[model samples]
Target: MRVLVYGSGQLAQMMYLAAAPLGVIVSAVDVSNETVVHPVSKEPTGVSLQNAIEDANAITVEFEHVPEHLLLDADKSGKLFPNVASILAGADRVREKALLSKHEIPNCPYLIITDVTDLDNVIASLGERVIFKASRDGYDGYGQWRMQSADQLEKLKSEFAKLDLVKVPLIAERMMQFDREISLVGARDSEGNVSCFSLAENLHFEGQLHVSVAPITDLSDSLQSQANEIFEKLATAMDYVGVLAVELFQCGEELLVNEIAPRVHNSGHWTQQGCDTSQFEQHIRAVLGLPLGAVDVRGVSAMVNIIGCTAFSRDLIGIAGAHLHWYGKEVRTKRKMGHINVVADSHSHLGNKLAQLLAFLPVEHFPELEAEANRLKNYTK
Candidate 1:
């Protein structure tokens, strides 16, 4: 089987690695230049976009932000998995909010802001503590602003006025004091069969995911059930095919939807070492109409992201059950360099492994590792 993926990034590269073992060939389109390239090495394949689209048995994407023109071309092939509407919902918050509202899914209270004066009513509607996000093309803390009190509204409106809100708009969300953030990663095959990995508790710093722990300690049956129900509703509504990731904010016993990722997600990266079948492999299986694999977890697992700094020792993999995945990209501030997946029989063991990993990683870049390690080291249940 041959699959062509849009947006040649780490996700596509991981998919290529996973697909190869299944006897599937994966090629990636460098959306920036529209040239087909080898997924890993990124060398040009000399295949035109049209030829690549026509040759592939399946078409998919590593990310949702592929240009509209490219997506339209792929859609015309009748091979694009998950469809264009699903991808657009993942890319634009305006469409995403509408989808959630239409489906009656619980999410943060929000107001759409298309004009500067929209801010004047935000406090009355959603309260003073809120986050403003670009309705399109915003992620990793970019194109976002926070207001803790009504006093900040005038200054915020001035900052927002400089931009053309009419073009992109803004989504003002009421911030909730959630207990923690978690995500469900699952696959829906063409036959409508679904399989979901264990929920992963995510930790983020400055809007970038820094670490994810799967089969989180203290997990409850009700919590997992809630997540599964949410997944089924959204996936079925879209008739989605391929892996879909649903991000949630856990407040007490209830899980409110935070966002939906229409492709393989950063939080699910723990599946590489933690689950019976990695999410990358499941995604490939779904898009190709192959039988879905088991989502059973092997043990406690933690995925620590390597962000920005590359000066750390690479020998951390020497720790038992520790695996490193480097993206082979040039380092820059806040850029995701790679990730480390560590699995253990118990939470304490996982914490010990992470503690050992810390010695090889610089402290400044990984502010949460030590704290997270300690918390897990003493964790119960």
Candidate 2:
């Protein structure tokens, strides 16, 4: 079997690696140039876009932001998994909010803004603190602004007034007092069968994910069930088939939907070493009608993203169950260079592994590592 993925990034590379052992070939498209490229080496494959589409057994995206014209062309092949509408819902906040509201899925209270005058009532409707996000092409802290006080409204409005709001609107979300951010990554087969990995607790710095610990300490059956129900509602509603990730904010026992990713997600990277089947493989299975793999975890796991800095000691892998996956990209500030996944028998052990792994890393690039290690070091349940 062969699959074609729409974005030639790390996710596509991972998918290619995972599919190899399954007797499947995965190729990627560079959306910018419409050329098919090798998923790992990223060299041009010299294959035409139309020919690649014809050759693929299935077509999917590594990210939601693929060009609409390209997505429409892929959809015409009748091989696009999760479909064009689902991808669009993920790419645009307006469509995403509408999808949630249409299905009665709980999400952050938000208002759409197409004009600067809309800011006048934001403080009245949502409150003083609001997070404004671009309706499209925003991720990892870009295209976002936060308003902390009523006095800052004019300055924000002035900045926003310079943009073409009608073409790319803003979504003003009322900030919620949530305890921690968590995500559910799951796959739904064409037959509607669903399998979900354990909920992962995520830590972010400057809006980029820094660390994620899976099977969060003190995980409750009720909490897992609630997350599953939310997943079921959204997946079934969209007729989604492939790996889907839902990021949630936990306000005590309630889970409020923050955002959804229509493709494999960064937060799910832990599954590569922690679970019976990696998310990349599971996504391939789902899109190709293969039976879903077990979601059972091997042990407690922590996935630490290696952001921006590449000078870390490679010997960190000497620690048992420590594995590194590098993206082989040129380093840029706040860019995800690679990730390290560590699995241990228990949370405390996992924390110790992370703490040990810290010695090899430069603390400046990983600001949250120490605190997260300390938090998990004494966790009991």
Candidate 3:
């Protein structure tokens, strides 16, 4: 079997790695150049994008920011997994909100802002604090602004005046103060067989994911059931046939959908070392119409993103249970260089190993991380 994945990034790299053992040939397309490349070798042997897609048994995406024309063409080929409609929903926040509302899936109350004039009413209704997001092409915290008060709103208007809100529009969501954030990465087969992984606790710094812990400690049964139900509703609604990620905000006992990722997600990266079936393999299986694998947790796991800096010590490998994944991208400010996954028999043990691993990281970039690690160690003990 062969799979053609859109976007040549780390997710595509991981998917390619997972498919190898299954005897699946995974190839990637560079959306910018429209060149077909081998995902593992990163070799550009010069195959036309159309030929690559035509030869694949299935097509999927590593990210949502695929070119519309390419997606349309793939749709016409009848090979796009999760389908164009689902991909479009992920690309635009307006479409995402509408899909959630249509399915009665609980999410933050939001307004579609066609112009700056609409901001006034949205603020009055949702309150002083609101999160303004571009309806399209926004991810990893870009194209987002937080309005804490009327003054901030005025500043944002002036700062973003060059943007034609009327043309692309924006999504204004009520800034929610949630107790914690959790995510569910689940897969749905063509026959609608859905299997969900354990809930993952995520921590974000400046809109980028910093860390994730699997089987969020003290997660209540009611909340788990609610998250599962939400995923099922969305998968069935979209007729989804691949891995989908649902990010949730746990406010008290209630969970509200924060957003949906139509492909395998970053937060689910811990599953690489922690689950019976890694999310990459699960996604490939689902899209290929194979039976979904077990979502069983193998152990307590923590995944820490290696962002921006590339000066970490190679000695980090000496730490027990530490696994590193480097993206082989040119290092730049705030770029996600790689990630480290640490697994243990229990969360307490995992926390300690994380502390040991942190020692090998640059102290300048993660000043408070050492302190936070100490606190976690004490708490776990």
Candidate 4:
């Protein structure tokens, strides 16, 4: 079977690798420029977008911000998973918030801002410390502004004055305290069957993900059940097919939805080595109307993102349980160049492996490696 994916990036490349084992052919569309390419090598497939969609048995996405026109084309084929409305919910923060509220799902208290004047009341209601995010095309820390105090509001307003706020409004979220960020990746088939991977503890640097440890340490049954129920609510609400990732905030024993990614997620990368069946494979199965793969965790796993620094030695593989997957892309600041997956029999052993692997990377670019290792090392059994 053939699958056409939107966005020819690292996520598409990983899906290509996973699909090969299942005898599936996956091609990617550079949604912005409307170019078709091989999901792995990224060479032009020399096929028209219309023809590509016509030939595919299923259409999925590596990211949600695909152009609406292409999505409409794929929808006509009746092969698109999760549908255009579901993707739109992820692309637009306003729609996303509405869905959460509609389902009675817990989320941070917030307001929508369509004009600079609206910001005044929102600030008065939500307070000074708030995060303003563009409703569309915002990711990896871009298209966002933070208000720390009243003085910053005018500056923010001026900066955003030229923006077409009416066309793409802002989602102003209250900056509330939480213990840490966690995420769950799950898959749902056309039949409404759902399967979820273990919750992952995530650490982000400057709004970008840096490290994720799966089957979270010190996990409670209640937390797992809560995450699973949240996933079920979302998937069933959208009649979502394929993988869906939910970023969440942990407040004591409660979990609040942070954002939804309607595709394979960076935080789920650990499944490549930690689980019996990876998220990529599971997504493929879900989109194709096949039985979902096992989401069983083989052991504790850590996935460290190789962001923007290409000089690190590839000899990290010398360390036991380290597996590297490098994206062949030009090195640029803040780019996700590749990732390394590390697995261990125990969290302490995982910590030791991480520290040992750290020797091969420059500390200046990877200071968190040791800190995370230390955290894991402190855990017993």
Candidate 5:
């Protein structure tokens, strides 16, 4: 079987790797040039976009920011899996909020702001400390501004005056002081069958994911059930037919939806080594209308993102339970260069191994962090 994937970043690369073993041919479109490139071989070929879609048995996306024209064209071809409606919901925060509300899925209270005038009422209603996000094309910390006080709002108004807020609009969300953030990566088949991986705890730095631990430590069965129910509700609402990731905020015993990712997600990267079926393969299977793979956890796992700086000792391989997957990308500030997965028989064992592995990472890249992490790891054990 052949599949066409939108976007040519690391997620596409990983999908290429996973599809290879299944004898599935995956090709990627640059989205900029509309150029077709073989996923595994990374060889550029001269196939037109129409022909590429015609030849492929299925189409999927690595990310949601695909151009609407291209998505519309693919929809006409009847090859787009998970559909344009689902993709749009993932791309726009307004649409996302509407979907959640329509399904009665719990999420942070939010308002759509088209004018600076609307901000005053929203602030008065929701209070101070709101997160302002661009409704479209925002990811990895860009296209967002935080308002902590009335002064910040005044400044933001000045900033928005320079840009066209009406055309793009923004989502203003009430800031919740949550105890932790967790995510569920689940797959749905055409028949509406769904399977979810264990909930994962995520740690973010400056709006970028830094680390993820799967089968979150001390996660209760009730919490897991709540997360699973939310995922199922979302999948059914969207008529989704592929891997979907739901990020959640846990406050006390309650969980609220933070956002939804229509494709495989960074939080699921630990599943590469920790699950019976990696998310990439499962997504491919779901899109191709194949039976979904098992979502069983193989062991407790931690995935640490290698952002930006490339210089690191190869001796990191010597650290027990360490496995590295590096994306061949030009080094730039804050780029996701690669990731390392560390696994152990139990969460405590995994925590200790991760602490040891952190010591081997260069101090320049991550400073004074290892000591605190080590202290916590030991204390928890």
Candidate 6:
């Protein structure tokens, strides 16, 4: 079987690696050139984009930012996994909010702002601390603005009013104060069999994910049940097939959907080392109409992203249970270079390993590592 993925990025590279042993070929489309390209080697595959789409058994995406025309072209092929609408729901916040409401899934309370006038009432209702996000294209904290006080509303209105709101309207969500953030990744096969991975506790810095710990150390039955129920309603509602990631904010005992990713996601990266079958393989299986893989949490696992700085040691691999996945991309500021997966028989052991891993790196480049490692080591169930 052959699959085509849009956006030749690390996700596509990892998917290609995972699919190879499954007797499947995964190719990529360089959204920049809009042509078939090799995912790992980053070379031309000599397959025209048209022929690639025509020949593939399935088509998917590495990210949601692929141009609309490319998505429309693939949509016409009827081979797009998760479908065009589902992909659009992920790329556009307006569509995402509507989908959540249509399924009665809880999301942040807010209003749409298509005009400067719209912001006034939304601010009055939601509060001055609303976070305005571009509805069409925004991710990892880009295309986002924060309103700290009502005094700044006029300034924001004057500056933002000039924008072509019709082309990229804004979604204003109340800046929620939640206990902690958690993410749930799950897969739905073509036959609609759904399997959810463990709820992972995520730590982020400047809107980029830094670390993730799976099984949550203390995942309550209530939280698990609620998360699965939400995932089922969402996947079934969209007729979604393949891996879907839902990011949530836990408020007291309840969870509210923050956003949904329609493909395999960063927070689920621990599965590459922690689960019997990784999420990338499960995603391929789902789109190919195969049985879903077991998501049993193998052990206490932590995923630490190697962000921006590439100075970290490959000697990190010398540590027991440490698995490194290097993306082989040019290093740039705040870029996701790679990730380290560390597993242990228990959560405490995993935390200690994380601490030791941090010790081998420069503290200046990895300040966040210390706090998270200490939290994990001192964590209470």
Off by over 4 Å in 1: none
Window of ten residues with lowest summed lDDT in model 2: 372-381
Candidate with the larger lDDT of 2 and 3: 2
Give the lDDT of residue 127 in candidate 4.
Answer: 90
Once all C-alphas are superposed, what RMSD does model 6 give against the true structure?
1.1
* Higher-ranked by TM-score: 4 or 5: 4
**lDDT tens digits, residues 1-381, model 2?**
999999999999999999999999999999999999999999999999899999999999999999999999999999999899999999999999999999999999999999999988899999999999999998888999998888899999999999999999999999999999999999999999999899999999999999999997779999999999999899999999999999999999999999999999999999999999999999999999999999999999999999999999999999999999999999999999999999999999888998999899998999999999988988866
In model 6, the Cα lDDT at residue 158 comes to 92
- Output the worst ten-in-a-row residue range by lDDT, candidate 3: 367-376
Candidate 6 local lDDT, 1-381, one digit each (tens): 999999899999999999999999999999998879889998999989999999899999988888989999998998899888889899999999999998899889979888888987976699879899999778898888898888888888998888988888899999999988899999998887889998999988888898899978678999988999999999999999999999999998899999999999999999999999899999998988878888888888999888887887789899999999999999998899999999988877888899899866666656578888888788755
TM per candidate comes to: 0.99, 0.99, 0.96, 0.98, 0.96, 0.98
Worst 10 residues of 5 by lDDT: 367-376
Tell how far residue 203 is off in model 3, in angstroms. Answer: 0.8
lDDT of each: 0.94, 0.95, 0.88, 0.92, 0.88, 0.90
**Model 5: per-residue lDDT, tens digit, 97-153?**
999999999999888989888888778877798998999988988999898887788
Error of 6 at 51 (Å): 1.7
Clashing pairs in 3: none
- Candidate 1 C-alpha lDDT tens digits along 1-381: 899999889999999999999999999999999999999999999999899999998999999999999999999999999899999999999999999999999999999999999888899999999999998889788999999999999999999989999999999999999999999999999988888889999999989999899987789999998899999889999999999999999999999999999999999999999999999999999999999999989899999999998999988889999999999999999999999999999999999999999999998999789999999999976
Question: Could you tell me the TM-score of candidate 1?
Answer: 0.99
- For candidate 2, report its TM-score: 0.99
Better of 2 and 5 by TM-score: 2
Q: Count the backbone clashes (under 3 Å) in each candidate.
A: 0, 0, 0, 0, 0, 0
Task: For residues 1-381, write the lDDT of model 3, one tens digit per residue.
Answer: 999999899999999999989999889998888888888667885878888888889999999989989999988879899899999999999999999999999899999988777777877788888999999988989999899887787777776677888877898899999988899999999999999999998888888888888888776888888899999999999999999999999998888999999999999999998999999999999989889999889888888888899999978988888899999999998898898888888777777887898779986655445554554566553
Sort order, lDDT high to low: 2, 1, 4, 6, 3, 5
- Model 4: residue 378 alpha-carbon error in angstroms: 0.8
Return the lDDT, model 4, position 271: 97
lDDT leader = 2
